[model samples]
Target: MLLEFVVEVPAEQVRSEVEKAYTVLQRTARVRGYRPGKAPRNILSHLYGGRVHADVAQRLVDATLNKALAEQSVQPLSQPAIAPAELRPDASFSYKARFEVRPEISGVKWEGFEVKRPSVKASDEMVDAEIAGLRRKHATLQSPDPERPAKVGDVATITFKLEIGGEFLDQKEQEVETELGSGHLFKEIDEALIGMNAGEHKDVRLTFPAQHQNPELRSKEGVFHVTLKDLRERIYPEVDDEFAKDCGEESLEALRASQRAKVEKELTQKASDAVAEQLVMEICKANPIPVPPSLVDQQAQLAERELLAAARRQGQRLDSNADLRARVRLDSEMKVRAGLLMAEIAKEKEVKVTEADIEKGYEELAEQSGKNVAKVKAEYRDPKKRELLIGMILEDKILDMIEAAAKITDAA
Candidate 1:
């Protein structure tokens, strides 16, 4: 874990640094009966004692550490721990730095791996389902008769208040519009809404699922006081050429073709991802590379931040749950290991990311996000972010190479 580096600058360089430090002190340090920038070196040293030497030593260590690491091609995961050393006026400066370097992964077997490639053809049934979904999206909502009760496939507008443990929950009385039996609400609540007429009130009790996203509400029982305010039926458009035209297609055939193409593309991407994931799993199992604790910890922190951001986006509060943190940490460790192995493979294969690759990456991002290239570039203004993007591009290229060299078999 400790990567040691030794750097010795010539006496001439040490003398130059000492003189520079003295010049700076003379301009900034005040002494008795001496004007600024006019103080002698001895006089400044007398006033400042070892301060000048300490400053010069620090500067020399910083400069030498960078230069030595570059020359030796050594990259550390953290700041180097420099051993304490004295700076003498007439001697060469020498210092030792100890730090943690990324673990070296050898004997990576990324080629000739056998993987199953799933067939990803789109079917007519899939196209029909997609078109049906489009028709439902364009459906019209009409108010049901006042005497009619809410039923499945009808949109119900309701105002509900929740009571947890017999205490009314604050800010729980809210109105929502949902289709009956749509699973948007709890199944019990959705069922209870059926056969309820407008202005009718009922109470539904339910227990939250164990795997609910909200940790506090998971497996908890609560009572909902519901009032059905209105009911509306959805009238879906007919699936024909007119509907296809409404969907920006010339004819029904064109619409189905477009949907089929979209489905095929999605399935192909999904299959590729599955193959890639399996390949990575196989590589990791074959080559058990030791991951650096620092890298794992860094990745874990990043994962935690992303999780918190996602929770905030959904307007949910996530408490400091130890179980969630542990799960995320474990996932992060695995990801870090996979990433290290991939990088090692990339290095061995001389897989490099060119300027054109980065530009293409940015373009793809912009296209997917519906943003301008300039906007996407501005978002990656941070140096670390830019470096991460380039690294990702390189990793992807390496993955492509691996897939090409892999022995693929059709999945049964």
Candidate 2:
């Protein structure tokens, strides 16, 4: 952890060095009370002498520190605190810095590890369930069982108002009908509405969970006045071969086969991704390196910004009152860990993204983004940007290489 840098001032150059700095300040200095390059050197010196002296000292220190660090082979993890001794008007300023250095790591192994890959294939039943979900999405509502109270899987119509401290935060309305469990409405209102005969009214007090997304609403106790207006449950008819034909399938078996095939394709991609992640983690575990906390913090900040932008795009407002710093800190740590782990794996495996690999990645991204491949390539034309994309591709290739070496078994 020992890092030392020397400050140098040549014996023959002290007077010239101070004069050079003074000359530059005279030419470049801009004072509010005087025109640029027109102010008297003595007047400027008198007006901003302390500030100019500090600035010049810092510049000289930065230049000397860089040279000293190079000569001593020392690297600092943080900015060095500068505390230079007072310099006489005729003497050159000089100072030295000593600080802790990041620990050096060597002789780490980062290859030849195995991981169990989870197997997932869409079954005939799964496909049928998905189709049923799609049908529900397209289903029309109809009044049924008017005599029964609301129950599970039944939609309830009720009028409710949110209150805080016995005063309503929501608009004051005698009746505002809304479906329970829809949007941000309480689930208990649905419970109370269900199985209740029409015209039945009740007031339910519910406590919001501490982890609620809205900081203002979190841990708040509010009473809801609800009146049961109506209740209805979804009714799904039998799905058989005839239903499959109506759904544009030759037969129920064909529909199930198609659904299973689709699921298998999706699962294959997912499993591949999971396998790559496991391999990277294994490699990183074997090859330990001290990643910079600053880099991790930067990654986390970028992620948080992206998340906020996405929320805005989706018409969701992020609460300024929420403790996002804690969330960002956790996210940044994870990202840093993953990055370090993958870097180790890439190093060990000699994994690389070839020109063709980058092209293929661009093609895939273009397809997903519904943009022309040429346009996508044009936007990422910079060599530095392309290298970053190549790194991601190389990481994936390394994961695939590890996955190929592993003995994968289908999970039940």
Candidate 3:
């Protein structure tokens, strides 16, 4: 998809452009011994020849690139990288224009492919697991009895004075809340708190890990004066009518029905997605072709940005390094290739988006966003966003046609 064009402008045009540049410059340029527009052409050329020639070169390309592309009937997808050159009087101005274009796909093999639909179903256990998750989400934290000691699965709040090699890490005692037996601080400390009661103090010795984030604490023997301040237990509500009401369901039976329906819908969508994936894989394997490097780069950038955004959401730092790009490069290439082939197939099928399709798309957007249809329409008024929606609709149309004809069999 990358093409380099060697364009040569005739000597006549070059001379004309150069003449225009000097004509404008001569009318405005200041000279040492002559009034403006009164200097000899040779004197002016001696002083400003390089500037005039460069301006002429840029103007010539700006004026003639469209004509050159029109002659070849080629449309570039990216901005052309014009090679460096200078204009010469009475000589052709030649330069290279390099850019990316859509690959000319000759043929496509996209029908009657054997694909598998995964045999996936939602089970009763899955629904129970989902309900259990809901209970955890709505769980409440409570203080344990004073007589009880800290144990596994109990959250312990404590203060510690840490010392390593006769130096204190914290100028004052640091308070931390961690789960007993979770190894959140250190395995030695988590184990030491297992049988300690509230208001109890204990001494623990540990070897700091070499890979610890702080260099001052790495690989050194440390002692902690630890006090168990308090203990907490996470309590989940029982799956009864009250819990159902709290979850916005009418009753316990209604909650189970709702969860079952959701689980079934998710399972069905997963199977359908698997079928689609198998179809695209088979089609790409059957008709392998080169993908445009620019498109792949664009996809990689989008993927990297999404990852960065996710890391930010999770309060983590991620660098867009060479390793990250290399990891996503192959997937980017495959995505570009698949998209191009599907577009080609859509063209072959003469699939087109109608006004009705656009309206339906708007309605679906409103439904998903819980917004009014008018606002949704207003949001897509930007031509770029509208075009993206049209493209998505076109892709869906093509995918529906291909999937209908695909030979789908359930996996064993």
What digit string (tens of lDDT, one per residue) describes model 1 on residues 1-412?
A: 5689678878999999898888877888867798877888778778885988888889988787887899989899977889856789789988888888988778788888889988788889999999989989999999875568888999999999988898878675799999898787888989998988889999999998776786888899999999998888988998889999999999999999999999989989889998988777777777777787788889988899898899889866565488888998888877878888888888787788888999999999999899999999999989998998998898789788888988988765
Best prediction by TM-score: 3
Over the stretch 28-97, how does candidate 3's per-residue lDDT look in tens digits? 9999999989999999899999888888888889988999999988998888999956678889999899
Indicate the residue-level lDDT of 96 in model 2.
Answer: 68
lDDT values for all models: 0.86, 0.69, 0.87
| Pick by lDDT: 1 or 3, better one | 3
Q: Give stretches of model 1 more than 4 Å off.
A: 2-73, 79-98, 145-147, 162-173, 186-188, 205-223, 307-327
Model 3: which residue pairs collide? none
Give the clashing residue pairs of candidate 1, or none: none
- Regions of model 2 farther than 4 Å from truth: 1-47, 61-108, 145-147, 170-184, 197-200, 209-220, 229-232, 245-248, 300-352, 369-375, 378-387, 405-412
Top lDDT hit: 3
Q: Which residue window of length 10 is worst by lDDT in model 1? A: 312-321
**Per-candidate TM-score against the hidden true structure:** 0.74, 0.72, 0.81
